[model samples]
Target: MPSIARVPSVPAPGDAAELRARARGALLGLAVGDALGAPAENLKPSEIRARWGRITGYVTDRPSGTDDTEYAIFSGLLLARHGSALTPAHAEAAWHAWIADRAEGQFRGAGFSERGTLENLRRGLAAPISAQHRHAWSDGLAMRAAPFGVFAAGRPAEAARLVAIDGSVSHDGEGIYGGQAVAAGVAAAMAGAPPITVVASALAVVPDDSWTARSLRRAVAVAHRGERAVRSAVVIGGYPWTDLAPEAVALAFGAYAAADGDFKEAVLTAVNMGRDADTTAAVAGALAGATQGESAIPEEWAAPIGPARGSCLPSMAGHHVLDVADLLTPEVEEGVALVPGTDLEPATDLVRETDPLRHNAWPPPDPTVFVLAPDQDEVRP
Candidate 1:
């Protein structure tokens, strides 16, 4: 556990260096907040305060992140590899190749939604069918959404679209909405949007009447009153599980709103609120970190974050968040579109020459041409 250090203010944005810093801050903050909030995950606020007085820093002697951080790294690597063309097929294949089919390591701690998705995949189910589980509305997707925001910097709609594609393999309904809100919020923050605009960006992506939207509105509405008030406004006290997407996303945004996007204050506010603490804090951390840039995080907190241990996903063992940040922060060329599985899209003439079907044919081709194709199934009649 590290002691709290003086937090720095956010610097001006608009350069590659600043983007990199914000990317680093977003991921490092997620890990830090995950580790900080792990011990308080499902406890009530009273229980958390009773156990650790106010919890200003890491509470355990050997603090480490949980499923939230590792899963975020997993999604980050997938996004880095595929970029804009990322599809549900790509995400599903990665889940099987990197996680579901593995047989070596212990399938340690993970959220119910992840376990459910893995079970469905092992049973030969595919997404979005694979996502039809009992806990489909869990915050599992939200926990791993920040990387999409990092990859689609300044493009909130693109971030929401990409994260939903990733979430289809594991979640649905409010779960998908929750992921969208977090990803959009981070994307706006990456572009140096103010806290109010960031929250608005999040709300704009989801349906206006959705559970996630409603809870988010309620939480932010009361955020000025503090964590207790925010918690009261959004949390469903009778619910047993604390990982509801609506509740968790609301709490996280509430914390961010309450602190006005200050990295340390936002993360701590989420942590102290108690229910689904790890995930709420992780989302809050990502938002605040993006808004404030990496320099805003306390050195004591950042120094302890390292390569993920892969307790939750063995394939992510040696990759660090900083490594992901580097992969996502490359310089963009002015008018060249980047392609997946390669560096850049080929010139128009080159594409036409290489791919005959890519260009428009002058006159309309025979309508029956497809009916005479050689590969058609033999017609016994």
Candidate 2:
């Protein structure tokens, strides 16, 4: 099992309190989007109403984000508790525990990318992590890159690079690039920057070697011109499972650009547009949640997005947006031991920090609680 060794989490230069607050905002942004966008995943405004009759509650299906947001949060919590990121190995160990216990870890049964990745990891197949796991390319990367951005606030390049490796574990091509772009945005948010700049920064890091990047650039270009959704998607070729990362990324960008910096509006716009509803929500959710903060999510729409605060769903990943941010506070940075494990000759491990395009990480992380199935006694609305 690949191992994520412990390393120092250096804070960006700023008033420590202010930095902590921004970190919280970024973290909250992910959860709120994951929750809010989830309910609107599959249906457009019309279909959503036709099917669910006016989606005022948390839409469990869409915001599910195939568990992207949850997994990202889970990684962060593990890092917070253990004080470093997980190597592929550590992540695998966590998965094994889940399988053994029927724990159904966070986003475990979501879809193709995760399923394939886990199977390969379980077999101890030591291959370099790359787009190979889900060779066809998928939206898995787009959803889970936010937490990495938050944790890697000061190192945008590092964040982008690291997330790409993470993405390769279950994604490839445009899918991996999507994770890179999203992580870039989160890093920008963590740095207390504007969304446009963050998104633009992300646009730059994605490789120019493919059509997805072109599509992403086109989407960004037209985001300000008009209703970016219809124009960008149709003109720029947005469609679910089309092997197009930019389309989804663009839709998210257009919604973000059109919504007057409102998290709710951005997510609503994406959900209302249709196709890849959940993944779109997952991507848009991570971006918007980073910008707007958890408070921006409506109370009425909050419940079905997933579980609420204080719930114990092992599969849901341990922390909600709120819990995640709280973990990054200025006060939380004291003697948390910047390292993750007991001891790895820091001298040797430190030198191996260059980010890999993918990972074949081993050693397996401790089991993570993907969702905490609620008990009947506490099932009140």
Residue 16 displacement (Å), model 1: 0.7
Q: What is the lDDT, from 0 to 100, of the residue 195 in candidate 2?
A: 66
lDDT of every model, 2 decimals: 0.81, 0.53
- List the candidates' TM-scores in order: 0.84, 0.69
For residue 155, model 2's alpha carbon misses the true position, in angstroms, by: 2.8
TM-score of 2: 0.69
lDDT of 2 by residue, 337-357 (tens): 222222221111111222111
Task: Tell me how candidate 1 scores on lDDT.
Answer: 0.81
Number of the top candidate by lDDT?
1
lDDT of 1 by residue, 266-341 (tens): 9999999998999999999999999998999999888878888888887777678877776666544554332222
Q: Give per-model CA RMSD.
A: 12.9, 11.0
